[model samples]
Target: MKILHLLRLGAFVAADKRLERKEIDLRKLEKEYEEEDDMELEDLDMWDERKPKQGMDTRKLDGRDHITTWSEAKKGQQLGMYVNTVPGLSEVELKNLFDLWQMNMINCCNFELTFLPLEEERMLVLLPDGKHLKDFGTMLRQDKNCLTFVVENTHMLCGGHPEWDPKRPGKNVEAMEKWDQYHKDKKIEDTKKKVEGWKESIPVENKDEL
Candidate 1:
């Protein structure tokens, strides 16, 4: 009977040791998990730091460095307008009429005229101010030589320059491709890290079961 008691005590001591070792292992795992969480937070902070701040301009990110928003004209200058000529008017006739009209109109003294090479029926007129542009539009609506006109302010009209032709390929295509590849590589790296961490978290004894 004494031998049996000694054997039982030995079993209990072995069980106790196993329990203590398991507890120690659990504590180590918890510490490692906390450390991984801290590392993830630091990575997130670093990524956030690389992003554009709120209300910050992001034109450079998208390769729109050549584009600029239209700003208000200064006191003495004015934004330009596109004028459409009468459908039947020849280029020479339109030019002659524009020259005569511009020379005669006292309000257009401070204005400048530019002829775009696109179409003979179209020209750009730069008036002195908003008030002058309004008056010019009113006069143009009454004139027989004019068809229609538009103020060149919006993105569609302003961006229709020959340099920004839609038929041409975008200048930033390669940059965009690089940006996409960068994101893909980062995603792959993150996935690999997650898989490795999951593998490390599994116990060696339980690996055979998986």
Candidate 2:
């Protein structure tokens, strides 16, 4: 029993260290995301080199062949099954980061978080931005999910040699662009519909006059 406990503790420690490293990467990502507008789209420097799997092509993935699997896997992580626990940031904020990292389209779905454990028992806090993060205290009060561990098969995201999928694109600015385009298109479509409605409301001869 003691041996099992020690092994579990060790794994947790390793995971914590990994999370810490990812935090540094996150900061770098944030900086790039902040400055992306000034950058040229053709620049390959925008890609995160760490994404490609071991023994795979060392170059940036300029093609779409490997990106799909990586994208779906990340989406799975963002919308994890059964439970979701975010430490400092609210659940939505963290998931938003994941989505942005993937450069995926905005997925505005109602997240029905079922529970928030005691502060100490909650997940470790990694990224905390008092200025940027929104208050989700109401979510905590309303949450109701059961707490449990989830095992993930991450090998798919970063495939080995013969297999391949680079890491998350780490291009949030690009992702935000997707949202911008979606909203822009929706606005245009809505305006068209509104004009059609107005035309219907007014008589055909009146439409020609005013």
Candidate 3:
């Protein structure tokens, strides 16, 4: 009878210890949730601060007009290059080329290199300004080794894509609208072409089925 009583006591103690551990875990989870809620509230406040003030000219505040004029003035400041494959050239050689250009030709600001999405062979190089970009183009044109590459001013390629002008304080809403329309029109044209191609591809007998 004494041995049975001791066994019961041991089981009760183990269950009590388990309950205490579960309570501790619950408290820790609640503390974590409280911290997350505090962070979310802080983010909401920051977002509210960015809202435009009532009765204010949003264009003036956003720098739209200023950016438009600045973009026109500094038109070809950035350049985009399409890098074609160079036979027998290693990655180290390509890096050396970029390093050489940065070290010698680029002044005031450095070049920004970005690879095109899904196309590793293509790259876009953002030059410092119009003058430097023109100079770089001239050098590339003269160099026989760079024949495979194609370079053009970004404005030429994108019909003046709206960008933030450092000299301006506001956003370029007008340019942004124009770019949006351009892309919309291009999309419509592309869709029309695809539909026309599909229609032509269908046989006269199969046209009823489609």
Candidate 4:
């Protein structure tokens, strides 16, 4: 009877210990979730502080806000991304840079980014010419989806052989001009056809009504 009593006590102790362990694990999980929520809230506040006000044309390019993605690194790191220039710079300057950049690197989506080996962790902007970009730099690490520029301080600016997409055209000033002219002609033709349709649709007022 004493042995059976001891065995029952042992089983009760084991069950109580397991319950205590499960409670501790649940508390740890809850704490982790709370920490994550706090981090997200901090991020939102930081973004609010850094973000520019609406209607700031200079801050925006081609009706889109200057897209800046933050680094997910434990320590702060440079960040960069590729984007097509829908309407970049003044029309003349845009064309000039486009031509120059195309000559150097095969044009992808209007522009390709290149990083420089800057010893200092300050921002490095990739421009068509060696001119400095105001607030941009290379991110130390990136996810697989991103296209990156291999930085070399010795090489010239915009030095990148980015991944290729066959559908885009290379540097062709004549072709662009032709394309612009074609669009203009099409617009004029479309307007003329609309006007003719309107004229035909208009019922002639009876002479008696006049």
What is candidate 2's lDDT per residue for 1-210, written digit by digit as tens? 434544665577688855553434445554465455454433323243433322323253334322333333332122221122333456565455334422321232223232333343233221111111111211221232212221231211111112121343222223446779999999999999999998899987798875
TM-score of each: 0.33, 0.22, 0.30, 0.21
lDDT of 4 by residue, 1-210 (tens): 434544665577678865553434444444455465554443432224433322323422322111221111211222332322322245454445435544444333343445432322122434442211222222111112122222322111121214222233121234446789999999999999987787777678633343
Whole-model alpha-carbon lDDT for candidate 1: 0.51
Against the true structure, candidate 4 reaches a TM-score of: 0.21
Off by over 4 Å in 1: 1-75, 107-117, 152-210
lDDT of each: 0.51, 0.36, 0.45, 0.36
Over 4 Å off, model 2: 1-171
Candidate 3 RMSD computed on C-alpha atoms after optimal superposition onto the true structure: 19.6
| Model 4 ranges off by over 4 Å | 1-169, 206-210
Q: Where does the lowest 10-residue lDDT sum fall in candidate 2?
A: 126-135
lDDT of 4 at 10: 55
What is candidate 1's TM-score against the reference?
A: 0.33
Q: Which scores better on TM-score, 3 or 4?
A: 3
Arrange candidates by lDDT, descending: 1, 3, 2, 4
Which tens-of-lDDT digit does each residue in 1-210 have in candidate 3?
434544665577678865553434444444455555554443332124433323323333223323233333333344455544334546666567556656656362444443342233334555533334434543443343342334321222111223433354232344456889999999999999998899889999988876
What is the number of backbone collisions in each predicted candidate, taken in the order shown?
0, 8, 5, 1
Segments in model 3 whose C-alpha atoms lie over 4 Å from true places:
1-76, 107-121, 148-210
**Once model 3 is optimally superposed onto the true structure by TM-score, how far is the C-alpha of residue 48 displaced, in angstroms?**
25
lDDT of 3: 0.45
- lDDT by residue (103-155, candidate 1, tens digit) is 64565445544445347677777654433544454455456676556654322
